[model samples]
Target: MLYNNITELIGNTPILRISPEVHKLKNIELYAKLEFYNPFGSVKDRIAYGMIKEDLKDIKENGKTIIESSSGNTAKALQILAHINGITFKTVTNRIKIPEVKNILRILGTDIEELPGLSECPDPTDPNDPIRFIENMVSQEPHKYYHTAQYSNMKNRDTHYKTTGREIYEDIGTVDYFLGTLGTTGSSRGIIEYLTEKNPHLVKVGIIADKGDTIPGIRNVDEMHEVGIYEKTLYDDIITVNSLEAINGMETLIRQSGVLGGPTSGGAFWGTLKYLEEVDKSLSEKKTAVFVVCDRVEPYISYIQKRRPDFFEVETHKDTIRNLSNEELANVNTISIGEALEWVEENNPLIIDLRGNMAFRTSHIPNSINITDNYFEELIDAGIPFSNNILVMLVCPVGEKSNKFVALMKKKGFDAYSLEGGIVSWRDAGYPMKPLNLKKKEQAVI
Candidate 1:
């Protein structure tokens, strides 16, 4: 039962039968392969190490560094494994929206080169973007770097074929319908090839983000054409899921089954449901559909907060609450950082963090509860009693959102104060802070 290292725990992820509540169908027997259980927390852990392991001796002997152009699951997997193996890792990343994932990359001491251009699938012709930068690095000095070109590398598709594909077939003898999102398309291509050979009747469904919608690690058809690893012919049908639907699926899974997976996983689930809605109920119930839960939810929590805030928003639309007038809401007073710190030292207040979960995860006041809205009142009313005179200090990245929220809470007869200058000021004032991890202390030791 003991392993020498985390890399040994790469594949053979557990598959759980999804609840009918999340699927909203009595017809399809749905199941999800939980890839978040992988050592670095993603399905990509399979290919990240699988693609690079054979080349390690050459890379180390030649004094070359491992490089990849990624910001999501792939980046996380590479950084963790590369560190464990004593390999120098560098990332070509753009503005990564997922704070928790980005924090992990930074914490690993991965050499990060930030691409100013914001496109995930930037034009290959643009020499400044991450993808093109990778091209130049390896093309110019091939020996100085070992690039695991995930998109075109058959190794990526092959690794999944050998591991992910074999595991699913062994676990569920017959998969009538298999669903996976399109990014590198390694997982889908591998599974589809292996399963169809086992059962020619298997229906392969490829999920894609709707046009102009941004779901992490998924691409539309037009955007996917450049990736050589994707197999268009294997898919019997391609389903499109928008950003909101994906988040809803993610939230539904968490609330119903207590399983936390990223939006790409949700996109696959949403696509499966969409597909079920179009098929005959009698036939679907007789079949089994398996979806890959691509990664964990921690990275996308802030994204979910921004896209569909209702999931985390407090129940303030009830009749038990009085409606606040705009005039009274607008004039609520704000408290300075120093004043807020002084109040914190003197009294125990309910600190509500208004920033997105990722931002709050980066740094916040200790013991503060992370919430999207003024739902702290809901908690208080629900019998986690608070004194009428006690303060509800609202913290944000900046003062704007918290100020408006402060105004609304004031009108509703709650003693609320917006921390002026927000968390940015808290750091500027040298106040003690808390992070989602003990990364600060760990970094000091390292």
Candidate 2:
């Protein structure tokens, strides 16, 4: 279809049904709103288009360039939207995002601002730090720049309320549960607010980052992205799933439904499945569950193919980590840093530092082994135990990488826990460390 403006392509994404085999147990109908069908190949297209249009409406008297912070998909969508409207686009993103996204941004002539350190924030509570960085750029360059502020932008939620929510309600009419990921909380909050107003019985379920407590129902302090203040108060219920569940779910979508979606979208789909199973057992009549297939998985093709070659080959393994209280991990399981330190001293649990080789070599917990030198296969081939009996604490400079690796190991049938603060926190806590010794001495130049 031809469109005169990007705003014209804001909504009306197609919805597809999940196969009967995929929904065998629940016996309830499952549908995914294929949001990738949007102009930018992601659901963020609606928000990017809507926010720009709204910003333009109020500021028609003045010209403004668009700016925002995004990991990948959102940035791409905004860039495409801004370009079509003849507005200059600038994006502040971390260097750790997928290379394909960076390539797209560069090709779109986006003035790229790269943030120092990890791409995703480690602390969700400190939302201002990232926004401040973006604000600094806007201050220095006053050339008609407006920040989209996805994390805290009410417009993001408004877009979904006006477009996506209406489309779903029109298509399904009676959706018992509205499920989606909690990246910015815009989609969930918008849909929940709109649908709940129409039908108070509609339940909104949100899937949050497993490392942190961004989700209302789950609690963790680890840093991860979440919807901003304006977007937080829209959900009825929330669920948290770790990287393993997300990855497995992504693989399942490809295998079962031929729907290749990103890890976050897969988590949403999995959460929806669990919700359906629960509601089915309780209710006498069949209920409908709908989720947004936020984006296509093509961008992650290289990373997943390289990291998880056997991901699709294996059958879905039952998750072994029981849902335990924080006290359990701290007291009974003894995985907390303080307790783990004691066990490290007494039992010498195999500590594999998952951080970069330089970070691992610079300083680490005493007696900790460095596994970053080789790939996972080499480490496993070199006699690393693959059983859950072994106590393994994956360590990094910070906790994010370690958390991701620990999740992968757990999926491979290993008992793994991430060091809370990674090596940085360990060093700050006055823990003992040894620096790598250099073999060659450098001479001073005049």
C-alpha lDDT values of all predictions: 0.75, 0.65
| Residues 1-446, model 1: lDDT tens digits | 99987888999899999877667676677888999989888999999999889988887778788888887778778877777777888888664756776777777777888765343222222234567679898999998888887878899888988989889889978888898899988888998888888899998989998753578888864467756788788898998987878887887777788888878888888888888766736562467888899888887776676566457874434322223355655686788887878888787777877554445555668878766433443453464355657678877665655765667666556788888877778878999887756544421110
Task: Give per-residue CA lDDT, model 2, range 216-325, as digits (tens).
Answer: 11222353334353343566766677655666777788788888777666777777776667677777677777888888777765445434555557442232222333
**By TM-score, who's the top model here?**
2
Scored against the true structure, residue 204 in model 2 reaches a CA lDDT of 78
Question: Which 10-residue window in model 2 sums to the lowest lDDT?
Answer: 212-221
Give lDDT for model 2.
0.65
Stretches of candidate 1 off by over 4 Å are 119-127, 282-285, 314-446
Clashes of each: 1, 4
